[model samples]
Structure formats: C-alpha cells, structure tokens
Target: MTDMRVSIAGVKFKNPILVASGTFGFGHEYGKFYDLSELGGICVKGTTLHKRDGNPAPRIAETPSGILNSVGLQNPGVDAFCAEEMPFLKRFDTKIVANISGNTLEEYSELAEKVAAAGVDMIEVNISCPNVKAGGLAFGTSCTSAAAATEAVKNHAGSVPVMVKLSPNVTDITEIARAVEAAGADALSLINTLLGMRIDLKTRRPILKNNTGGLSGPAVLPVAVRMVWQVANAVKLPLLGMGGVASGADAAELMFAGASAVAVGTALFNDPYAPIRVRDELAEYCENAGVARVSELTGGVKPW
Candidate 1:
C-alpha cells in the first residue's frame, strides 16, 4: 500500500491533499457533504484582526478556464474564529491551518499571536495581501515587505509553525522565497491568484467590482507548476503548492514539480467533493505506478 502521509515543519498530514484557504471556508459547509477527517488538512478562510465585509457586489467573474475573485478577505475576525470557529474545527481529526492577513506588520504579529494562543496547528501568513500601509503594494511583491511580514509573525506566533504564502504577481518568486526562508518561515505555500480582469464589451466596464481580481483555476495550472518548481529549488522549506489544481493528475504534476503537498482551491466551487476525489485519484495513480510512498513524488521530475 502506498503511504500517503507526509510531514511538513514537523506537522504530519495523513495525506497530501489539503483544501486551500478561502475555498474551504472553515470546512463547515463542505463537512456536511463528507467527513472532514477524510482529507489531510484544512486551511480556513483568510482572517484578519477584525471582521471585514469584503468587496462590493460583483466580486466574482467566471473566465474561460478559471475564475476571478476580489473577495477581499471577508471573515469573522481572529477573536470570532478562536471563540466560535475553533470548536467546530477541533471536532475533526485533520490538521487545521489558520490563513492570516494584515494591513501592517504589527497587525500581522497581533493576528499570529492571537491565533497561535488559540491552538492552531499552523499559521499561514498571507503576505500576498495588498499592503494598505504601503499604498496597495502587495507585501509579497517585495523582498523587504515579505521578509518583514515573516519575521513579525515568527516573533509572535509562539510554537505554531509559520508558513508564508507567496504571491505569483512578482518578477522573481525565487527571490521572495529565499527572503522568507531567511526571515524564519517554517514552510511555504505558493502561486496565490494571478491578477486578471474581464470586461463587458457591451457596457465597456469590468465585470468584477474591483475592476481587476485574482485569477484561479485550470488556466493557472501551468504557471503554478512553473513557480512551484522554481521556489522548490530555491528554498529548503516545504511547499504547499496551489493555483488551479483540479484533478489527481494535476496534483501529481505539482508534487513532481516539488510541492511537499498540494492544495485544491477554485475547483471546490464546481465540486465540493474535490478534495476526497483528488485524494482517491492520487492513491490510484501511486498504485498504478508501483510507488511505495506518495511522498516519493516530491521533486521527482528529471531533466531531459
């Protein structure tokens, strides 16, 4: 039998398939469809220090093979997540990762401290968030901001392992990856949505209220794979690869490219059972290939 288990930053996951943050929404809705324990881990929606209403109407736009979203980190805030959401999540046997975002370095530290004290398995610092303090420049877009965010979270996150989520909207992802690794990030997750826009020809206006939004789905798969491969070789931190993962083959591609584990995101909107399906398919893939352990696929790709 293939051993699907893998450990990242000392946290062992039952399998490599995890529901990406913002897609799983605390796992309460998806839990009704299947047992949440069936999967390896769950990344709760992005949470801030305080509640946020999110972007205005028309925040989603369906593209050719992907979707554009400007959800703007809508959540019940850090206090509410610990007070109300943790109870529901704790009942499950799966690993829970809190995806945290902040407008400033101090806010990131505060959110990390609160969530860490609340007993989460890991904290995913979402530096890809547009830094309001820096006039909307995404924190992940620069080495300085990314390293600062990682350092601040590490200082206040206590013992909970910190994973910095990298944004794809940058010139060199490797530079940012190395920067975070140096700043003391325990792990990394990459290829957050690519910036995109859809305009209505008739109205000559953007479909999403934010005008341009983050693109995610099958359309971004190739880009995700490329970025994962680059970051994997650049840093020693385990990577949580994502950005357009939809099937088992897709998951395998990311794993082979160098992701320690893979995350299913936009696919969840079309199929709620995606995580389980992908896990099963991945098992089948390993069985057919005669691989003893699924983790062996990490960085398995060879040069021509």
Candidate 2:
C-alpha cells in the first residue's frame, strides 16, 4: 500500500490534500458531505482579531477560468472561533490549521496566542492582509514586514507550529520566503491569490464591488507551481502549496514541484467532495507510478 501520510513541522497529516482557507469555512457545510477526517487537514477560514462585515456586496466575479473575490476577511473574530468553531472542528480526526489575519502586529500576536492556547494543530498566518501600520502595504509584499509579522506571531504562538502564507503580488517571493524562515516560521504556504480585476464593458466600471480582487482557480496553477518550486529551493521549511488545485494530477504536479502538501480552494465551490476525490486520485497515481509512498513526490521534478 502507498503511504499517504506526510508531516509538516512535526504535524502529521493523513494525506497531502487540505482545503484552503476562506473556501472551506470551518468545514461545517462540507462535513455534511463526508467525514472531514477523510482528508489530510483543513485550513479554516481567515479569522481576524475582531468581527468584520467584509467588503461591500457583489464581492465575487466570475472570470474566464477562475473567480475574483474581495471578501475582505469576513469572519466571527478570534474569540468566537476559539469559543465556538474550535470545538466543532476538534471532533474530526483531521488536523485543524487556524488561518489568521490581522491589520497590526499586536493583533497578529494576540490572535496567535489565543488560537494556539485553544489547541489548534497548527497556525497559518495570512500576511496578505494589509498592514495598517505600514501605510496599508501588505506584510507579505516586503521581506522586512513579513519577517516582523512572523516574529510577532512566533513570540506568542507558544509550541504551536506557525506556517506563514506568502502572497504572489510581490516581485520576489523567494526573498519573502527566506525572510519568514529566518524569523522562526516552522513551515510555509505559498501562492495566495494573485491580484486581479475585471470590468463591465457596458457599465464602464469594475465587476466586483471592491474594484480589485484576488484571482484564484485553474488560472493560477502554473504560477502556483512555479512559486512553490522556487520557494522550496529557497527555504528549508516544508511547504503547503495552494492556488488552483482541482484534480489528483494537479495535486501530484504541485507535489513534484516541491509542495510537501497541497490545498484545494476554488474547486470546493463547485464540488464539495473535491478534497476526497483528490486524495483518492492521488493514491491511485502513486500506485500506478509504482511509488510506495506519496511523500517521495515532494521536490521530485527533474529539470531538462
């Protein structure tokens, strides 16, 4: 039998397939479709320090092969997550990774402390959120700001593994990866939605209410794979790769490119069972390739 288990920063996942944040929404709705324990892990929705109403309506727009969204991190806040959501997620055997975002360093630190103290298996820091203190620049866009955010979370996350999620809007993702690794991040997740937008021809205005939104879907797969490969080479930390993973082959491709694990995002919107299907397909792939273990696929790509 092929071994599907993989470990990131000492946290073991039954497989390499995880549902991305913002798409999975705490795994409540999807849990009704199948046992949440069937997959590797679940990166819960992006939680903030306080409740957010999110951006204005019409926050989503359909593009050619993907969708653009400016949900603005709508969530029930960290306190509510710890008190309410955590208990529901704890019932599942899969790993629970709390994906947290903040507008300030203090907020990030506090969120990390509370979630870690609440007993999450891991913490996925969403640095893509704008740093209010830095004139609204995204923390993940600069090495200094990214490292600073990672350091602040590390100082309070206690023993919980901190995995920093890198944004794709930056010029050099490797620089940001190296910076976070040096700042004590236990692992890294890359290729957060790329900046994009669309406009209505007749109205002569943007489609999404927020004007600009993050693009996610099969459209970003190539970019995600390339970034994962680059960041994998730049840092020693394990990577949880994400972007446009929809099938087993896509998951394998990301793994070959250097992802220790992979996450399914936009695909979930169409098929709630995408994660399970990907996991089964991945197992079949390993069996067909005569590979005895799935972990062996990480960074397995060969350059011509």
Candidate 3:
C-alpha cells in the first residue's frame, strides 16, 4: 500500500487530509456520518476566549461553485470546549487541533495556554478574525500584527505546535508568512477564505446580513494553490494548504503546488464523507502515478 503519512511541525498525521475549522464543528457532528478516525486529523471550529453568538441571520450564502460565510467565530468558548468537547475528540485516533481566535493579544495568549494545558495536539492561531481592538482590520493582513499574534500563541502553547493561519486578502502573503515564521510559528496554514460579497438583484442588497463573507469551495482552488506555492517557497515552515478543495484530485493538486497537507472545508458542508473520499482518491492517484509515498508529491511540480 502507498504510504499516506505526513508530519507537520512535530505532530505526525495518519494522512494529509484534515477537516478545516468551522466546517467540521469539533468532530461530534460529523462522527455520526462516519468513523472520524479514518482521516488524518480534525481542526475543530473557531473558538474564542468567550462564547460567541456569531453574526446575524443570513450568515451563510450560496454562490455558483462555493459558499460565503460570516459566521463570526461562533463557539462555546475555550472553557466549555476543554471541559465538554475535548474528551469526545480525544477518543478518536486522529490528531486534534483547536482553532483559536481572539480580539486582543492577551486573549489569544490566554486561550492558547488554556487549550494547551487541556492537551490538544496542536493550536491553529487564527489571525484572520477582525481585530476589534484595531477597528476591524484583520490581524493576518499586517506583518507586524500577524507576527505579534504568532509570538503570543507560541509563548503559551507549551509543547503543542502553533500553526498560524494566513489570510489571502493581503498584498503579499509571503511577507506575512515569513514574518510569522520568524516569530516562532511551528507551521502555517494558508489561503483562508477570500473576501467576497453577493447582491440580491431584486432587493439591491447584500445576501449575507454581514454584507461580506469569506468565500470557499471549488472556486478558490487556484488562488489557494498559488499562495501555497508562494508561501511554501518563502518560508521553511510546513504548510496546511486549503481553498476550494473538494476531492482527492483537488487535494493532490494542492500538494503538487507545495502544500504539505490540505484541509477540506466547504466540501465537507456538502459531503460529510469527503475526508475519507479524498484520502482514498489521493492514495489511488499515488498508486497510479507509481509514487510509493504520498509525501513525495509535495512541491513536486515541474516548471515549464
């Protein structure tokens, strides 16, 4: 059998297919559909220091081949997640990642310390959340803020590796990637949803109540691959590449572009079994291509 194992930072995964945060909802919801242990890992929903009610109604809107969301990091907060959610996910054999975001750097550090103490395998520092302290500018959009956020999480994350998630809405993503890497981030996950909006023709208003949302699904794959390729070459840190990934072929394409691993987000909203399907399909591709190990595909693309 072709080997599908991949190691990110210091955590070893059974495969390279992980469920993107927000879309997987902490694993319990999707566990009802299939064995959660079959995939590489699960990055739970975005959690904050305190509980969030999320944005108003119409938080999610459908587009041609993707969906836009302004869920506003809705969650039961870190305390509840540790006391109530962690035990359930710990039962699975896969790696567990807590995707944490906060309005302030202190909140980010505290949340990282809490989840790290609670024994999550990894912490995904979400700097893409609108910085309330900065009047709504996303932390990931600025090099200084992004590096500061990564340093904050790395400080309190203990033995758990910190993976900084990058926003694609910047002029130069590699600048942010290099900054975070220099700030001691153990890894990076890139191309978080692109900013997008849609209008209702009859009403002449935005479909989402939040006015704009992060777009994901098959539509953003090209952008994701390009960013992954760029960041992968820019920094020595490992990458969890995502955007418009729905199938094993899509996952393979990202790996070829330089993603050490790929996350399935919007696709999971449509197919609960997408993780396994993609995993199987990736293995099939490897076998057909005469590749013995899946890791061989990372940055394997040849320039014309």
Candidate 4:
C-alpha cells in the first residue's frame, strides 16, 4: 500500500488534495456531495473581518474551457464563520483553513487573531482580491506590501500557520515569493485566478457583470504549474499549488512541479467531490508506481 500522507509546516495531511477558498464554500454544501473526512483539508471562501454581500448578479461567466468570476469576496464574515460554521466545522472530521482577506494591515491582523481564537488548523491570508483598498494591493502587488501584510498576520496569528496566497498578476512571481518567505510565512499558495475578460460580439459587452473577472480552469493549468515551480525553487516553504486543477493527473503534475500540496479550485464547480476524489486517485497512482510516500513526488520531475 502507498503512504499518501504528507506534512506541511509540521501538520499532517492525510493527502495533499485540498479545496481552494471561494470554490468550496465552507464545505457544508459539498459535504452532501462527498465525505469531507476523505480529503486533506478545505480552505473556505475569502472571509473578511466583517460580512460582505459580494458583487452584483451575473458574477460568473463561462469561458471556452474555464470560468471568470467576480464574486467580490461575498461571505458571511469572520464572526459568523466562527460562531455558525466553526462549531460544525470543528466536528466535521477534517482540517479547516480559514481564508482571510481585509483592506488594511490592522484588519488582516485582527482577522488572524479572531480566527486564531476560533481554533482552526491554519489561516490562509488572501491578499489577491481587487475590491479591497489597501491590504489587497500591498500584500499582492509588491514585495513590500506582501511581506508587510504577511508579517502583520504572523505577529497576530499565534500558533496557527499563515499561508500567504500569491496573485498571478505580478510581473516576477519569484520576487514576491521571496518577499513572503522573508516575512515569516509558513507556506505559500500561488496562481489565484489570472486577470482576464470575455466579450460578447453581438452585445458588444463583457460577459461578466463585473466586466473583467478572475479566470480559472484547465486553460490556466500550464501557467499555474510553471509559477508553482518557480516559487517552489525560490522559497523553502511548502507550496500549495492552484490554478486550473481539474483531475487527479493534474494534481500529481502540481506535486511534480513543486507543490507540497495542491488545491482544487475551479474544478470543484464541476465535481463538488473532486477534493477527495483527487486524493484517492493519487494513492492509486502511487501504489501502482511503487512510490513509498506521495510527498516524495514533489519536485520529482527532471528538466529536459
């Protein structure tokens, strides 16, 4: 039998497949689709210190092989997550990584502190949203902002690990990854949707109500894998690879590319049970290939 377990930041994951934030809304809805205990973890939607109504209607637009979304961080806020969701989440039998996003460093810290109080496995600091005023810009666009935001959260997060999620819109992802590393981030998750747009020829307008949206799906797999490899090489931190992960093969490819663990985002829309399915598939593949541990596949690929 194959050993499918992997450890990141000293925390053990039964498998490396996790559902990315925003794609798997707290796992309560998807729980009806699959057993949450089968997967490694679930990174809940982007939650701010307070609740948000989210963007206007028609926020999701379908592309040729992907989807563009401007959900605008619509969530029940951190407090509700702690009070309403956390109780059930605590009993759900899987690790929960609460994803936090805010407009200021103070907000990020406060959210981290609150989530730390909520008793979760980890905190995923989301600095990629465009709607947020300050923290979003500083944490995602520049090395300064990224490090500052991460450091602020680290200071307040206590024992819970902070995994900074990097935006793919940056020019040199390596610099940003290095900056976060220096900022004391325990791990890194990369390639949050690429900025993209889809226009209607007959209507002469964009498909999404927000005009432009974050593009995610198979169309982004190649680029996402490349960025994961680059950041993995740039930092010693565990890399949570995400982009257009749709299948078990894609999850393995991310591990081969340098992701200690992988996140299934857009693909969840198609298969709500994808997170667990991917894990099972990985174990099967590892057993057939004579691999001892699935984590050994990380960065196992050789360059031509």
lDDT score, candidate 2, position 95: 98
lDDT of 2 at 211: 88
Pairs of residues clashing in candidate 3: 217-244
Candidate 3's displacement at residue 50, Å, is 0.5
Per-candidate Cα lDDT values, in order, are 0.91, 0.91, 0.89, 0.87
Which wins on lDDT, candidate 2 or candidate 3?
2
TM-score of 1: 0.97
| Candidate 3, 1-304: lDDT as tens digits | 8899999998999999999988899888889999889979999988889998888879888998999888887799999999999999999999999999978899889999999999999999998754122312368889999989999999999899999999888899999999999999999997788888999999999999889888889999999999999998899999998999988899999999898899998998888888889999999999999989899999998867
Residue 10, candidate 3: C-alpha displacement in angstroms: 1.1
Tell me the spans in candidate 2 whose CA falls farther than 4 Å from its real position: 130-137
> Candidate 4, overall lDDT?
0.87
lDDT (Cα) of model 1:
0.91
The Cα error of candidate 3 at residue 17, in Å, is 0.5
Candidate 1 error regions (>4 Å): 130-137
Q: Write the per-residue lDDT of candidate 2 for residues 131-151, one digit (tens) a residue.
A: 122312378888998999999
Q: Which stretches of candidate 3 lie over 4 Å from their true place?
A: 130-137
How far residue 252's Cα lies from its native spot in candidate 1, in Å, is: 0.5
